[model samples]
Target: MKPEIFIQENIITIGQLLKKIGLIQTGGGAKFYLEKNKVLINNKKPEGRNSKVKNGDLLTINSNIYIVKKEQDI
Candidate 1:
């Protein structure tokens, strides 16, 4: 159930990204999901909500995982 949307950045805030992309049902949903230890970075377990996601990294939530390729040019 991985998502196709990619996050591009040298260090992306998980909470901000989640809200920006409408992944969680709500803003609080992101914190709740993260506190439940349901989020992983680069296939490794992540516990910090403010964790930064860099390029070529991987992120997983629930059954969905996303790989951070090149940063999206804004």
Candidate 2:
């Protein structure tokens, strides 16, 4: 199943993504979680908390998948 993520901007950071997924509550928590767990962005581990994710990007956290999509202005 493909999960959609709608955003108003061109991209979102890794830390923001974690929060959006409800994985972490705070920005500092995101940092700590990323350091402890393995998060794959488009099949590769993220370089840092600020890694940019854009449309069509694939994010896998703990084996679950999330797909980034453009927000439809309907």
Candidate 3:
């Protein structure tokens, strides 16, 4: 099964999600990271740092896959 990331908010920006998952050291790094790395949301590239990621979304960073789930669901 893919790794799961539990979030309390209804939606989170891709930047925040990257930080929450420890993919980036800080939120500011998201911009540069996104430019250098391949990040896919539900099989497509994200719009940018501000792109929205919500419950049940699939996040792909490099070769890793993560599933977004609400905190209450766990």
Candidate 4:
């Protein structure tokens, strides 16, 4: 499947992004989920909900892919 794009500001935490994308009901849930699942960021499994994610970063969870993009002001 095609990767889903998440447009945000300068940056956001991994946990925050997960919640924003509806992967979790709350940011707190991200921590619990990450503990049992391996999420690949830029092709590497990064640990921590505080992991900084910026534009162009690729995240893969299970078989789904998410791409972070900076939202440009029109």
Candidate 5:
């Protein structure tokens, strides 16, 4: 399923993504997930907590799939 949030910019941080997904209990929880390489951006593991995420990005966490794309008009 798709997330209710939208990615307007070409890039976003890993922490921001996790928080949006409701995976992280608090803002700091992102650090634990990232530190353990539990966060993957576009399949591969993220380089760091501040990794950039762009359009067409696919995020998989705890078996949950999140697609980031521009909101196109129907």
Candidate 6:
């Protein structure tokens, strides 16, 4: 099953999401990682670290899948 990540806010940044899921050690790493790897949000490439990620959005990074959901949905 794909891992689920709960968002307390209506939206979260791609960088923040990466840290929350332990993909990157720090927010600063998101930029380098995004540039070096394949990260898809809803099947499309993200603009950058600031790209918005909302509830129910699907994220595929380096062949791994993660689902974003509201905290209350759990």
Scored by TM-score, the top model is 3
Candidate 5: C-alpha RMSD to true structure equals: 3.2
Count of clashing pairs, candidate 5: 0
lDDT of 2 by residue, 1-74 (tens): 87777666678898987887688998778778888987888999888899888989987877678888868676
Any idea what lDDT model 5 has? Answer: 0.72
lDDT of 5 by residue, 11-74 (tens): 7787876776576867787778887655567789877667877778887676666777756556
Off by over 4 Å in 3: none
Between prediction 5 and prediction 6, the one with superior lDDT is 6
Candidate 6 Cα outliers beyond 4 Å, as residue runs: none
Which lDDT tens digits does candidate 6 get at residues 4-25?
A: 8888999999999889878899
Q: Least accurate stretch of 10 residues (summed lDDT) in model 4?
A: 1-10
Ranking by TM-score: 3, 6, 2, 4, 5, 1
Ranked by lDDT, the better of candidates 2 and 6 is: 6
lDDT tens per residue, model 4, 1-74? 55666665788888888788888998889888888887878888767888878898888888777777888888
C-alpha lDDT of residue 64 in model 1:
77
Against the true structure, candidate 2 reaches a TM-score of 0.84
Query: Please, what are the lDDT tens digits per residue for candidate 1 over residues 1-74?
Result: 44554665567777766776786666567777687756788777665656777776677777777876665687
Residue pairs clashing in model 1 are: 8-71
For every model shown, what is its TM-score relative to the native structure?
Answer: 0.67, 0.84, 0.91, 0.84, 0.68, 0.88
C-alpha lDDT score of every prediction, in listed order: 0.70, 0.83, 0.92, 0.81, 0.72, 0.92
Error of 2 at 18 (Å): 1.2
- What's the distance in Å from true for residue 62, model 5? 2.0
